[model samples]
Target: MDWGSIFSNAMASALGPDAIVYALAAIGLNVHFGYTGLLNFGQAGFMAVAAYGLAASVATWGLPFWVGIAIGFGAALLLALLLGVPTLRLRADYLAIATIASAEILRLVFGSVTLSDWFGGSNGRQQFANTFYDMNPYSSRLDFGLFSFSANDAWVFTVGWFLVALSCLAVWSLMRSPWGRVLKSIREDEDAVRSLGKNVFSYKMQALILGGMFGALAGFMLAIKQQSVIPTDYATDITFFAYTALLLGGAGRVLGPVIGAIIFWFLMTFLGGFFSSAASIDLIPDVVMSDIQASLVRFILVGAGLMALMIFRPQGIFGDRREIAIDGR
Candidate 1:
């Protein structure tokens, strides 16, 4: 029951590469649901396609890593268009249904035996990340007193955080521009924006593309960090978690996702460690809860916290309540 180890693990997760990845994903969702009032439940689909695009291009087609990156982003752009073209003009819920269903379809397709040759079924692909690692400058691991990371992890962290920063800056800048104003206006009332002679449909499409591209970048981070890509990694739950992080940090605010990701992972790992350590000390009877059950109980607690947040503080930690008052109509 070493509390130090547990605390270190939790702290690492708070600022780790995984948190950066989720932050990036939530940033994309912020653009859709936060700023533009788009209900894109298939963000995981965008991530999955981008990851597979990169893996298949480099591993199967023998393309360069950079080219694979381009292909992956291209796939994400295509997906956004395909999804938005048919559904954006309809009610918001239609887009939600379409996105969620499309994401599930993609997960199944990638894991299906019929496409095992290209996607490798459920095992996914590796060996494509050598090019990324070959460029790493650090020769040894980074030893920070509380936590340490391999050279590879250090390099990924550098790139991942840089991307997160760049994305946030972009969102901030965009939201201040005329285009950003139109997006916000649409979120509040599409009819009003249309009455002003603005192209609501086109604006929605653009938001979808921009947000999906961000999600695609997140896909790259997740894939490059682990040096592998799996279908299960892009499940529907990932999107839900991103939404949670978005809500936690304060949606419609540029930096909400970043803060939310840190807090969410911190709480998750922190509670996990405390529960596991308590179990080891035999403080609780087995009849109360076993070690395995402790692992899941943390999520239950976090879920309850989220419910409380929704009930008492729906605007989140940094979000202004009015910012989220956009009319879905």
Candidate 2:
């Protein structure tokens, strides 16, 4: 079954750009869902707007990359305000619905024919990452036995992982502060926090903005990795996968999402490659599952695995049961 190649490829995928992107996204989700008790089901929307912000600013308006970065953060902040002002005081599910709906609406609008000129209407934007790659220090490919990457990917990884480290450090530091404790207290019981004279809504909005900024950074990393932006790239499915990563790693723990992202991609690519190799060697009947089916079966297996985890250990690999016991109310 060519286990060597399968394992090698899986390892590579674990450390690849996709893993970095999702790790950042899941980190943002951890802040929203794990720490703050926010049901932000539209994290992908944050990522989308950020990506388009950079793309449109650079490709359409001929702005510099740094300007694009500013625009991206602005868009994310605006989106957070738009979503939080009317919904933060409502039920948790209301925020979920609003975020998910806003994300879908934004995706459709970006791809709409009327906005094709600005957003490129489905094909997305390209050639916007030159500035990032131009700063690469490596002149040759990096081969690390089980994994290898191009010079460009090396640059992306260097910047992306650095950002991830900074995000984790920020989360770690913030969660230890008095404000961070208040956030957790609010998560456990908002009414109590409110009674104690803390402005619950304000804290929630701050967390939203903070987390959305993290998501925007992920979007920037992703856009730079692909050197382009597409509406479909930020689909709701991305948010779900990120959530899966958060749950797998143990949400609310500073490193949970990061570890979860690594493990999730590792298992996914490993199982996928293993199944494809087995099918190629005629160990599995074609009628039972084709090559395409082999590729997709991993997600089914992963889904079942997640269900098992939720049933047996809902707190996840690193989560404390008491921490997640907080009422969403």
Candidate 3:
């Protein structure tokens, strides 16, 4: 196992487009679950809709990439409104249930055979990113000795990071204002905010829609990054991973999810490569572990780490304990 290669790849993964994608998604989630205490269990649903929205728009409707972007955001905003209006008035778990159910429903609907002509069904849609790649300024591949990326990936990384920065800056600015204070107040006690004559429901709707739009941006980046949109890629696991990023970085804080996404991807890829390499070449006897064992080891390690994080430091690396203690509804 080439340690240098493993380390370089791991670092590249941390700093590459994958990190940017997850960071964008996690940041949006921070707005939802972290600050607003929305318990939005279907973040991937928003991402899926946005991704497919872009792909379908361009592939079937002959729309421009920018139009697809708008469509994606519009779909996510609608999803947020649809999910929030019905469930936000209820307890936290109800929002969670509705979100998760809605996400799965969207996935199943997108995968339906009836929509295959347009959505490509289970195979998903592609060729929606040609216009995006056509905007690339760099004609040659980019390399920094330790790692390298194709011209296409570099363009994706550049745009993706830009979106992440914009989203973070937006969150930072908003969280410092009176409006942000209202959100925190609602998280602490909606009843208290209501008593103060604040329109709690409106605030909740705004939070949901904004967060969902952020998720939509992430989905847009993901769609262009991969140059494709597959329904399976936006599974519930993506939501779990994004949540891990939020928990790892700390919720409610502007920079938590970005830091969490980088670290989470780094450790995950690094440990996975390390353990897999060690298990190979008979470093570990088959009795103790086989090649197949290496595959499951990373998930177990990452899961245990997440468990430890929740148990010992629920507030995350950047979050104070108070940040995690939302209204106990």
Model 1, 76-175: lDDT tens digits are 9999999999999999999999999999999999999999899889998877878999999988997789998889998988888899999999999999
lDDT string, candidate 3, 139-158, tens digits: 99888798888899988878
What's each prediction's clash count?
A: 0, 0, 0
Q: What C-alpha lDDT values do all the predictions have?
A: 0.92, 0.92, 0.88
Q: TM-score per candidate, in order?
A: 0.97, 0.97, 0.96
To one decimal, what is the Cα RMSD in angstroms of model 2 from the true structure? 1.6
Per-residue lDDT tens digits for candidate 2, residues 1-329, read: 78888998888888889899999999999999998999999999999999999999999989999999999999999999999999999988999999999999999999988999999998999999788899999999988977789999988888988999999999999999998898888878899999999999999999999999999998999899989999899899999999999999998899999999999999999999988877877788798888877888899999999999998888888988775566433
Candidate 3 residues lying further than 4 Å off, grouped into runs, are 321-329
Clashes in model 3: which pairs?
Answer: none
Q: By the TM-score metric, which is better: model 2 or model 3?
A: 2
Ranking by TM-score: 2, 1, 3
lDDT of 3 at 11: 85
